[model samples]
Target: MITETRVKIDWDSLGFDVVKTKSMFKATCPIDGKWSEGSLVPYGTIQLSPAAGVLNYGQGVFEGTKAFRTVKGDVILFRPDRNAQRMAFSTKRLCIPEMDTEFFLDAVLKTVQDNIDYVPPYGKGSLYIRPIVWGTAPALGVRPVSEYTFMIFVSPVGPYFKGGVKPLNLKVSTQFHRAAAKGIGNAKAIGNYSASLFPLMKAKSEGFDEVIYLDAIDGKRVEELGSANLFIYKEGVIRTPALSGSILEGVTRNSVCRIASDILNIPVEETDVDITDVLKAEEVFCTGTAVVVTPVGKITYQGETTTINGNQMGSVTEKIRQTILAIQRGEMNDPFGWIFPVNQIFKR
Candidate 1:
């Protein structure tokens, strides 16, 4: 049990930004060997070579998940194993050494335990956990490094959007492409995100919350939002873009589909979504670990605007959001076995 003195923080006012906690977990591996047993270290800057592989060739990948403090004060993680599986896929795609599932889960659990006091109170927000792996060896050659580093850090975050759960205005970008057809889009690689910075900034400057990226091949089919997966509720069916090689397989997106189909008893479909159809949907929303679920009020494509659900969050979106939040916070039964209690892993 974490019996340390709790840190004083204004949890309610927190945003989706980095607030450095007390400690983090780190491990390293050599080219010819396996990863070391990692240790928890005080949070600080890590020494990296200027010519490190991650700096030069962008040989890195990351995963985002959260730990919520239940109403009874027990901290629990939401689908961390799934995050580990996704990270493994990302590492393999980047030619980096894959981390063991057990090792990855341990690093995350210990990092959260080491900083348990920093977890925001129930209903305030959750402690966002980020695990990243990168090639650390310095070399001028454009290849995988002989050494790699894996680290996990936690930050208390409220919501990705400024006003939590409110509708957002998004713009469709046909010029900038988030990922290529045969590129590393499916992988949670660092390069994929770096490519989105420009388009995301452009959308935000135009008074939009985020940019909705279209397919690179034709720019007609919807790919996803810059930072999340897109979903639309139409004609009593919840639809989202199929996981093409160019779209990321989001953990929350999977959960939403399952919950909608099994729990909510709504038909769910994952297929190619055209921008034209999205503009006419009954309700539109985006899903991810950081945002949880955010309803889209309007989408502007090619100087045209369309409002969803009368410019408000629809009934279906609100119900799904509340159900997922309830399961995450231990306020309801987790029929899917998604919630893993921290106490079950580490006894007090």
Candidate 2:
């Protein structure tokens, strides 16, 4: 049986902390063209070569998703297959071996199952699943390693932003850009984030929650925030920068499009968005696996500031959040079949 004791959770505390748990699912890949036996083992890390390829060449990729508790004590993962497909795209960009979609999803499902008891209740938080694939082989020179290890782990997490979703203040930084045209911006790679820290810190210190990065080449089009995809609501229409080669094609972004059009009857604009126009939008926000949806209240452009929806959460934002959360908690009919069930009823 799993080992940790539950601490009588409040069932409404959506905070990010590791609930004491017994084991995590693990697997290893070797150059023998095979993956060894994967099993549920105590959570820990293994040794790696000091000169690993991942260290030298940044040969790694990862995907993030969550598993939420149902009303009946069941755990469910949201669109894990979509995350698997995105992981494949990330792996290919790094020249890492790809796990078949079925195998990838199976690994996540099994891992979440092993950690199901740790999933928080209805309003608390969900268990965060992280699947990382990195080159294991060591080489003095820079090149893709011959062997790679793809493994998965789970952690009980609260709302990523804590407390609640509030309108955010943004600082526009024209000095450094998040991603460039025809670059690795579209991939979920580690380096992409490693490069955003300094600038993000600067923005934070400058009285902003986040920095909206613009295109590097032209400095006119909006790309994305450090971690989420951006959106603009204007003229009774939602417009987001078209998925050019530079933006990560987000799963949440895709779902919002379908949800908006099919359920809310709102048409969306998918094309390049001018940074100025986006900042001046009536309603601006971002979406991702973590933040689900967030409203941008104000943008601090070059010496000028604009308030999107008066820096308040818009009506559309509330509707989207409610519908999405209802679907995730299994309280609403899932017309899209985005959830994957992971638990069985018990007599505890």
Candidate 3:
């Protein structure tokens, strides 16, 4: 059993950077064996061979979720089951052994519980959970490896954007493609993120907060950002790009849609969103586990810039952000059964 030990830190000054916690959960499996019973281990680095399959062929997948210190003095996970399901899908796509959802959830629970002391206070921030799987065995060929490793780690992080909750300025990138059609873009593959780094860096250097990529098939429809899903509210309707086998299926995007339709009684649709629709949108925002619901103040494409909602966060955008935060922090009733109270289920 892992004992809970309090980790002292400057929670008030916490940012999105990784703050190491007490322990991490780890487990391993061979190509012909089942996953071993995982346990909490002291947080540290693991050795890997130079020719490891993950290092050579990029056979790794990762999932992100959050555990919040709620107003009710409880530590709860927000829709972690969805993350587990996505991880399984990603592993299958990468030709790795499919991860059982139960196994994934149990590992996350153990990791979070072991680091329960790092869960920030009710309003400071939430503990970010990252679950990753990779092919660990050394390999010189291009085929599947002989072994795999799955690890879960927790970090206490604040806002993703450094400058508080300000509206973002995004640039439409027609020069690069995030992921190709009929590719592993739908999976949370590590290679997909590696491909996005250059475009994101170039966008940042050009004075944009993020780069929004268009569909790989045709450069007409908007896809998503480097790390978040895009949404536009126009004519009282909310629309995001359809999951066209390229865009990542974001958990926060799904939550925002559900909250819009069920709680706020707003119309929501997932369809092919064109650049023209975004240029004329009443409100624009992006969603992810890290960036929650950050509004896009402006979008620039081909020397033309369009200011959204007069370069301010729209009322509807704020409504969605607040509503989701409320549910996560236990400030409001959870009608969708999303919050998983970990402290209640697993006592210290």
Candidate 4:
């Protein structure tokens, strides 16, 4: 195992682009539950064969979330338990070792808390937590590797997009589909993201910031972005793509729905979102822990373009984003109990 060596950090120039933290937590898959002790070490590479299962068979899953500093000098983690459960779903689909829910949460909390200093100030930015589980053994054939590893780390991140809260233009990819219907579309697995790199780049080169992937089967319905789940707002109501077994069950997406209904008194509709409807939507936006709330201004389809209402974050969006931010900052009342404060730690 490698060790995390502390280095000088340029906090003044930090953005949400690269990994800054040097330390991470790692634990190997326990054969028959005979797990080895975990460790907090330098964030570095793991030894693997050229014919590793992950290299050939693409066996892996991942998760993304953030920890933020509250207004009152406290660190809070936005809904973390949901991340654990989602990992379970990803593991089940990728044939990886079942991560014990309790253990998973415990490890992640400890990992983030250990690097609390890496967490930025209340308003500057946040600590991004990325947990990855992957097969380690080298396998030339198409089979699950017997050995696996799980690790978590933290890095302070700024606005996910280069510009802050700027409206984005997206393109509908009718050629390359995001995910297969029954395949790993819903799972936050490695290959799923790997498959997106090409099409996303093509869309980027085509003068769009993001590519909106459609269902592979028919290519008529909307799926999601390369990184986050999508939501559409219009006519005093919010709408998003339903979990069609191809859409990842996004934690932030769910929270937005709850806030819209319980707090804002707006109805949130989760169902099949027709690409054409979103094109004609009064407002279009996407949500995730990283992106937060980003409004879509225009979508370029072939040669035609459809503009969302006002081409800016709507009033409802502003309200919900502020509400959620307040909850994270421990400012307003947490009526829904979405934020989880760290109270325990795992000492080495």
- Per-residue C-alpha lDDT of model 4 across residues 1-348, encoded as one tens digit per residue: 111225445555567876757689899883345334678888776677887677788888889988888998688888888998999889878888787777788888888878887777777788899988878777777888888888897888888888788888998888888788888888898988899999998888888889899888788899898888888877878999989988888998999999999989999999888898888787788888888888888898767888777677777778888988888888898998677787632221
Query: Candidates sorted by lDDT, descending order?
Result: 3, 1, 4, 2
User: Candidate 1 — which residues are off by over 4 angstroms?
Assistant: 1-5, 346-348
Best-first order by TM-score: 1, 3, 4, 2
Residue-by-residue lDDT tens digits, candidate 1, 1-348: 222346867776889899989999999988666665989999999999999999999999999999998988899999999998999899989988887777898889999988998888888899999999999999898889999999998999888899777899999997899999989999999999999999888888999999999999999999998789999999999999999999999999999999999999999999989999899899999999988988999999999889889999998999899999999998999999898888675432
Model 4 TM-score, all chains together: 0.93
lDDT at 105, model 4? 81
The list of candidate 3 runs beyond 4 A from truth reads 1-5, 344-348
Better of 3 and 4 by TM-score: 3
TM-score, each model? 0.97, 0.92, 0.97, 0.93
Q: Tens-digit lDDT track for model 3 on 133-225?
A: 999999998998999999998899889998878999999998999999999999999999999999999999999999999998879999999
Worst 10 residues of 2 by lDDT: 1-10
Q: What overall lDDT goes with each candidate model?
A: 0.91, 0.80, 0.92, 0.82
Instruction: State the local distance difference test value for candidate 4.
Output: 0.82
> Which candidate do you rate higher for TM-score, 2 or 4?
4
Clashing pairs in 1: 1-348
Q: Write candidate 2's Cα lDDT for 77-149 as tens digits.
A: 8888789899878988988876567678777777877776678766667888888888888988877788888
Candidate 3 positional error at 21, Å = 1.1
